[model samples]
Target: MLTSSTFSYAIGLILQSIAARRTITSNSIERGLVIRLATDRCYAWGLAAQVAGFLLAFYARETLPVYLVQAAACAAVGVAAVMGAVAFGWRVTRAEAAVLAVLTVALVLLAGAAEPSRVTAVPPATGWVLTALLASCLALAPAAWRARGAVPLAGLAGAAFAVLAVASRPLPALDVTALPLQPLAWLTLAAAAVGQILLAAALQRGSTTSAGSAMDAVTMVAASAAGLALVGDRIADGRTAWLVVGLILVVAGVLAMARVGTVVGEPIRHTDNDVADQPITQGNAR
Candidate 1:
């Protein structure tokens, strides 16, 4: 089932987290830092997982509402934290444990409350608005990075991903041969590139809690509203109150662990000799 894509999302985030954690920081400028992360040997695995998550999300959107899908996206961070504990020996604090539980309840409520609907026609202006949204993300990225704070940069990353979702919304219905002519398809590719870069940058320089929470907050909430108003996403009869409750719990869950931080215990950077002798693999490629 597509609900299983949540696990794929989690695994991808975990791999990407590992890549971001082990990144070498010395002598790298801001732009250079992003490039380094993108090209890091570990990031190749992360990128592959990200591609998987992207495809899974595309399929899942066919049957689920954007709000629910983005909630799963947000919850994927908690799942990654749990994976880190199990696979990487990272310790989980009490607060993180609590957030995980809250996420579980929120997801259940969201899933039960959602009534998936086919979007027959999107207004012409809506598609163009998404294109414009991607453009704004590109134009504002430098200034956003200059702001140097997690909320601004991560928030921008979230907005960019929202564009990715909206652009993807109508694509499942389009003919394969028509994709080249579809503005939404082109926008999807651009949004994915911009969103991936900004998200990696946010995760690398900022706290996991802040980056994940802030980024998903914007995407889950904003994209949900956009889905309802623009893309015809819906709630089941008598499920509105439950949906609201679920979202409130998600808010409470994120707020509970709100603190300044980054992922911990990065391994030491290897010597130049070690780098020169390392064997290359698919993980080494972008």
Candidate 2:
């Protein structure tokens, strides 16, 4: 389920990136508008993919430890990075490749060290925590919007996603008939939507490598903490040290991926009138 979700997310991102590039290059006014429409459509598809991924992930969290599920999902970053390199022509340095490889190993270790999640009914306090998290993300959105860099926006998005992950812990089993009746389910959906919007905005504002890394790192830490505190998730017997080491490596690798520069083929060229709206930046190039 996690693997399938990651593939869906990668495909969605690639489509959205392609559409964004098309929107920038259309020669005729009508053609530009059409391209813009297509870009929006692509974004919708991306959103759908993300929503589906989150649902599957949330459902899995019921049985799997949070760190394990999250680690598996965060692997989507690698998929996105590779797609960006191949589809958008972003060049990955050898160092970036090395870091990604380390990240993969760390995920494996984290998963191996995770004990099964404690399955229990949702506690009342869980609702309050989810509300607070949602409110915090809302408060940060405006500030992230005003920031010049993608890190703030990406971080906010990651945090919002963490909230969704936490909320998902108590979610009633996914049922077409009963899910809509649950308030927590609605809250989870709202949080996912907000996270996706913020992430997309962040990606538009800067390099995917940077934005994706920030999102993944923040989500891993935040979600793991929430899982431990709110859902009583624990490491496998005598595996605390392993979990800690794996987490450190995961964070280090994510930061390394963020710092590595990406070089895309045929730089996105913008017309004079479109210059201010041009989203690509040289900062993304090493």
Candidate 3:
């Protein structure tokens, strides 16, 4: 499941990146942007791949530590780099290859250190924590649409994805009928919705590597921390050193990826009348 999800995420993101690039070049109108993101054949297929990845990750989390699961999921960045090359002729630099190598080693160690926890039910405080985090993202969103803010928007979307992942921790343990009444389940939907919107916006304004790497870094770290502190996820016995070293390597790789995004063959096109301060939806779409 983990390995498959890694590829699915990579493929989905790559396709979505292509879709985003196409729309930004020729599309106009505010609401039309969102519509195109959904209706564009490439984007829709990309979304389907993401949904498959989500399902795979959802079940994988049932047996692994959240840190391990999240890290493994974010490993898609390396995959995306290679796929981008195939799909868009993006070149991976020497530095990127090194980062991908380090990232792979880190994932191996993290996987080795993960221990399946018996704790399945989410703590009551989790929902409240998710609510607070969701509110925080909403507050940060306005600033994300400003000039040169695509990375920040990606970060916020990552935070939301983290929230939803954490919120999903207890879902499999719950009775099917109880989901509708469960506040966390509802919060999960809201977080997923918000994350997708912000992520789309981020893709609209940023390079795939920059936006995706940022989102993956934030999502893995935030979700891993929340899982450890709030939800009792555990490292394997006598493997604390492995977890620590693995996390350090993960951080190093993610930071490197964020610094250098896998850009497409051509530079992003800009029209003469383009807005400088914000996205078209914000300025002229009104």
Candidate 4:
């Protein structure tokens, strides 16, 4: 599930970057609309990939604590950062590289300290799960409405995704035939969709560093708490200190990466000679 989620997210980020580049290079209003249409296609592909990753993650949640799954999922940011650098000329500073390394080490420690999930054959109570999902969304609505910037929006998006993760716990076992019969599954889908929309909006409205970091921190904490309180997830015996340390390191590293702008590239400028050397195109001024 981790591998699948990582691969899918990587693909999604690549597509998103391509779409962004297309949007940047558009020369006129009509051409921009055409470019936007193409970009939408890329965005659709990216969204599909993200959805696939989330679904796999939901399944993994059945056997892993929400914190564990979420922490691992946060690695997607690192993946996306690398992708941006490779495909979009984004540069990673030395500090960002060190932070990424710290994040990797912390995740390893967290994984080692995690207890095996207590698997149950029976699904959780549907009514309470539904109520919780609804109530959480309603509660978060005010904050979402009041949010003023990308960081707040990203934080809200993280909270929404955290709710989605919790809602996924009671889902009927991975049978495609049983999905429609499960209300929790449907709720999970709705929560995921909402979260994705908010995340996209946040990305559009603000810097990836600020928005992404806020989202990551909120999601990690919310998911961890929900897992412990609602799903009966526990840390490995005698590993509480290590777990706490790992969590701190992971969160700090993620924030550091965000602050350093690892996932988005600095704007590139063309030199006069380079511009002059290019052949004239239809969009060029006479």
Candidate 5:
């Protein structure tokens, strides 16, 4: 029985992978088809890394509870950030590291306090879920078109993300094959992919932290609730309730740290100097 927190980290990593692919895809046109192919290759490697990490996480889960797994996932961000620095020569300053450290600690403590064994039943396939996801995408189009900032775009994308998260984790009560082939599932999937692309572009345009915050919030809440409501996840006891609280705190901590980073790393500058100025205004002050 995995808790909501566990799912949150898992989904966060999934979104992070999507964001990474978006980063590569951004230059698809300028880099040409060959670059696109290369980007796909990189995407494959990232997927592989995730798979390996998950396998390790599963093993870690055996000795530790779900919270530990979530904490471990938080730790992986530090690894990823360092990889970004070492492999690509992307510099990481003390402030960024500090923020990430605080996030890691919060997640670790949350995980330590969380309860274990909260399993949801696998949902049966249903047409309505698909329909709802499709409707969400259609609704988001105009909003996306009109979106002026990263936040709005992230919000729109978050809407689509909510659809996918809810649709993917279908209610446990339903039958798989009995369920109609959902156009909504496909649509929501497409929306999620595209939303991520838009999210990455917005992040690049301004604040990665802000974009990350939006992505994290939208995806986590959408997925967790879907798991709970439709799939039969329960917080029926003290341990489970405490675990849920820890997860929320963990999520809040990560987003808070990200927001702090956004504020400290002002003016949207990508250089060391951007963060060198201390916790000034968020992104290239207007």
Candidate 6:
């Protein structure tokens, strides 16, 4: 479910962040090698989570509704929050906690309201669109690298990640072993793979807050909207109403959380060599 995947990502990110901080500080060739290895591991695990989540929904589409699966995946955000708190040693405020509770309830209600059906299979154009979009995102990585501010890098990364998420959605139908190949499926995989890599690299360049927020809030949501619209996915009657409301609540909650700056998504261990570009004190971690 989304809850489990969310928990998985939160933990993965926290671990990745911790490792990045250490490797960045040590600056040893060995450390660099280790960091690359860690990145690969994280990428593999993340890919698995994404694929599993999507396939679960696809396979179950016959029995369960689309909204239910998507909403369940949305629950992963909550898991991310919990893991973020633990990893960063941050405490949740009463208001934030209340917002999360409401979000959870809203998602659950939306899922329960869904209608199940077997929609038409994906078409070829989907492959071209995904490929082009992903290619575009990768092209932007150079700019993100040249950019100085954390915000710009984060923004570019967000866009790239959004493209990645969009590409990842149609993956369940891919048949890698088939003839010349399913160009569409391959395109989707390429986009998702490149997008996640770029997104992860973007996170490596700045604070966890900027990184995670860009990845989760900005990129993921934007991509989801694009997929729903472009892929011809429709929202069920009541669920459509709740989707709008749920989106509003999610945005408000994110903004409220953002007001309290600093990377609250992962922990940092201090060492003599470590330089604080933005020193987020313990008091501000929340």
Every candidate's CA RMSD: 5.3, 5.7, 5.6, 7.0, 8.2, 5.7
Per-model TM against the reference = 0.85, 0.82, 0.87, 0.77, 0.54, 0.69
Could you tell me how far off, in angstroms, the CA of residue 120 lies in candidate 6 after the best superposition? 5.3
Ranking by lDDT: 3, 1, 2, 4, 6, 5
Q: Candidate 6 has which clashing residue pairs, if any?
A: 2-73
Q: RMSD in Å for candidate 5, one decimal?
A: 8.2
Among all candidates shown, the one with the greatest TM-score: 3
Let me know the TM-score candidate 6 reaches against the reference structure.
0.69
lDDT of 1 by residue, 1-286 (tens): 4556667776776666556645543212366766777677667777787788788888778778888887877777777667666765667777788788988899899989999876645788888888787788888877776665456767888899998887787777667898798877888898888888887766666556666678877787778878888888899999999889887777666545444122232232344433433222212211
Deviation in Å, model 3, residue 32 alpha carbon: 3.8
Badly placed stretches (over 4 Å) of model 2 are: 17-39, 118-120, 172-176, 261-286
Top lDDT prediction, candidate number? 3
Q: For residues 1-286, what per-residue lDDT tens digits would candidate 4 score against the true structure?
A: 7768866866665454333333332121232433353347767787788778877887777677777778877777777777667766677778877877888888888888788674342346633654575567657655654555567657877877887777776562457787787666677777776676566655554555666678888888877777777767779888888788888987887788677754554553334332223321112211
Better TM-score candidate (2, 3): 3
Q: Per model, state how many residue pairs clash.
A: 1, 0, 0, 0, 11, 1
Q: In candidate 2, how many Å is residue 105 off?
A: 0.9
Better structure of 3 and 5 per TM-score: 3
Pairs clashing within candidate 4 = none
Clash pairs, model 2 backbone: none
lDDT of 5 by residue, 35-102 (tens): 34335543355435444554454444333443344444444434444444554344576766775666
The TM-score that candidate 1 achieves is 0.85
Better of 1 and 5 by TM-score: 1
Off by over 4 Å in 5: 1-79, 109-134, 170-194, 260-286
Give the alpha carbon lDDT tens digit for every residue of 1-286 in model 2.
7677666666665444433333332111232433353447655676567667766777777777777777766666667667667766667779878877987898789878988655555777877887788889888787776777668878988888888887777663456577787777788888887787677566655666677778888988998888888878878898888898888888778778777745222355444444333435524321
Per-model CA lDDT versus the true structure:
0.71, 0.69, 0.77, 0.66, 0.46, 0.51
**Which ten residues in a row are the worst by lDDT in model 1?**
277-286
